[model samples]
Target chain A: MIVWLILGAAVMGFLRRVDLYDAFSEGAKEGLKSAVRIIPGLAAILTALRILQASGLMEALQRLLVPLAEALGLPGGAAPLLLIRPLSGSASLAVLEDILKRFGPDSVTGLAASAMMGSGETVLYTCAVYLSAAGIRRTRYVIPVSLAGWLAGCAVVGLFFR
Target chain B: MSAALFLMIVCGVIYAACTGRIAAVEQAVLEAGQEAARTAWRLAGGFAFFGGVIGILEKAGAVRGLVRMIRRPLRALFGRDTGQEALEAISLNLSANMLGLGNAATPMGMRAARLLSAEGGGQPSAALCLLLVINATSVQLMPTGVIALRSAAGSAMPAAILWPSLIASAASTGVGVLLCKLLERGGR
Candidate 1:
C-alpha cells in the first residue's frame, strides 16, 4: 500500500515535470528550516511536560480525574491517557498500551483505545507543523477547539463502549 | 488546574534561576529541551519533505487530477466546490493523516489554507473554519499508530480496531461538517 502511494506520487511528479531530485532536496532544506522555527516552542512544551512528570502532577491529575473517568465509563486509570492525549501521542500510546495490557483489550480499556484510534493527537502537533510552515504566531482557537474534539471523542467512547 | 499552573510556573522560574551548580531542575530543563529539539527536528523534517512533495504534486497536476476524481462524492457530502484546488489539498491532508503520515499532511493543509485564503480574497473565511472542522474530525484508514500500540501491548488482534476506528472517524467527520454548515448559515 505504501509502495503504491509512493509510486503514484512519483508518477504524478514525473508527469508534471517536477524534477524529483530538486523537489526532494528543496523539501529537505525547508524541513530543516521549519525544525529550527519550532525548536523554542517545542522546548517550552517538553520542559513543562517534564516538570509535570517530576512533580507527580500527572498522578494527581489521574487521581482527580478517576471519578469523572468512571462516570464517563472509562477505567479509573485512563484519566492519564486523557491528559496525555493532547500533549503527546507517543506518551498517550504508552499509557494506552499499559492499560490494555493490564485490563485486557476487550475491556473498557479497549474501548478507550478504539476512541483514541479514531482521534489524532490534538492541535499541538498539528499547530507545530502548520504554524511552523506558515509562520503563524497566533493560534487562538485551534488548541481549545481541538481539545473539545478530543474530549468529545473520549466521552463518546466511554459512553458507548461501556 | 490553578495549582497545576502554579507548580509549572514555579518550576519554570526555579529552573530558569539556577544558572549553575548542576541542579536537578537545570538538568531536567536541559533534558526536556534536548528532547523537544529532537522531536521538533523529526517533525519539521517530515513536514518539509511532505510539503515539498505536495507542492511538486500540485505543480504536476496530480492534486488537481485527484480532486477531479473525488469531486462528485466530496461535493455530495461537503455541499461545496469539491473541484477547487483547496478542496483537493484538504483531501490530501486528510488522507495523509489517515495514513499516520502527519508530516506529509502539514504541507497539504497549509496549501489548502492558502487556497482557501485566496478564494476568500485574503480574509480568514468560512473555508478556514471548515478546514479546521474537517481536520479536527478527520477520518482514518489504517489507524497505524493504534496498531503499533496494540502490538507493543501484546494484543492478539492489533488490527481489530480498524473497522471501529473508521466508523467513529466517519461519524465524527459527518457531524463536524454538518455542524460547520449549520453554524455558517446561522452566523450569516
Candidate 2:
C-alpha cells in the first residue's frame, strides 16, 4: 500500500510537473484542514467515554450484558467490545485484544471478533465525519437504519455462530 | 500510543491549569489543533479522490452500464426496481463498503439519498428504504481494515477471514433487507 501510494504520488507529480515534496506537502495541508473541523466532535466523544469509564458506567453495562452474552454464546468479557463497538473502532479493538488474550483464539471470543471484523462502528460517527465534511445536517433516517443494520449483524453472529 | 498521547495531553492540561502555567495549556491546544488539522487534510484528499473517481466513473457511463447489468439481480434480491438513482447509490455504496471504506461511503450514500428524495417527489419511497437497508447492512468482500489489524497482531493469514466475512456479511444483508421490507409493510 505504501508503495502504491508513493507511486501514485510520483505519477501525480510527474503528470503535473510539480516537485514530489511540494505536491505531498499540498496534500498534507489539505488533509490537516479537514482534520481540524472534526476535532470538537471527536473530543466530545472521547471525553464522554472517559467520563463513563471513570464513573464505572461501562462496568455496570458489562454486568447487565452478561446474561445476554451467555444466551448469545459470546463471552461475558466480550461485553466491553460489544458496548464499545458502536462507538469507536480503535477502542473496540483494544477491548477485542483483551478478550482474545483472556479467552484465546478459536473460542467464542474469536468468532465475535470475526463478526466485528466484518462490521462497522456507530452510524453517528460515520454520519458526523462525512456529513460534517460535506456540510450536510439533515439526514433523517440514516442513523436508525445504520443502527438497525449493526444490530442485525450482531444478532446474526450470536445466533448463527452459536 | 495514540491513547497514551491523548492521556498525556489531558494530564498536561490539568497540571498546567493547576500550576497556572497558561502558556503550557495554550501550547497544548495549539499542538492538538495542528495535529488534528494535519489528519483531516490527508483524509479529505482521500475522500475527494474517492468521490471524484465515482464521479468520473459515472460520467464515463461505467456506473450506469454496470447498474444495468446488475439491475436484474439487484431487483430480484431487493424486490423493487430501485430506480436509476437508488441503483447508482447502491453501486457506489457497495463498492465503498466492499473496500471497507466507511468514510468514503458517506458522501455517496447522501448523494443517493438526495437523488432518491428528489425522484420520490419529496417523499421517502420504498426504493429509498431499500437503499437505507442495503447501506446499513452492506456486504463487504475485502474487509481490509480487519485484515490490516490482524496482520499487525501477527496473524499468519490475515486474509483467511475474507471468505467467512463475505458469507456473514451477505447473510446479514439478505436478512436485513427482508426484515426492513416486512416491517415497512407491517407498519402500513
DockQ, per model, reads 0.40, 0.15
> Per-residue CA lDDT of candidate 2, range A29-104, in tens?
4334544556654554454444444444455666797776666565565566556666565667777666655655
Q: lDDT per residue, candidate 1, B24-48, as tens digits?
A: 4556767987897788767775777
After superposition, candidate 2 runs with Cα above 4 Å error = A1-55, A127-152, A159-162, B1-42, B73-86, B119-126, B156-160
lDDT of 1 by residue, A22-117 (tens): 776676665456567667656666677666655555556767877877776766756777677666666777777777877877666775664665
Q: Highest TM-score, which number? A: 1
Looking at model 2, give its docking quality level. Answer: incorrect
lDDT of 2 by residue, B121-156 (tens): 433555555665566555667777666666665566
TM-score of chain B of each: 0.70, 0.67
Single out the weakest 10-residue window by summed lDDT for candidate 2 chain B.
B1-10
Of all native A–B interface contacts, model 2 reproduces a fraction of 0.11
What is the lDDT, from 0 to 100, of the residue A136 in candidate 1? 44
Model number with the top DockQ: 1
Native contact fraction, candidates in order: 0.32, 0.11
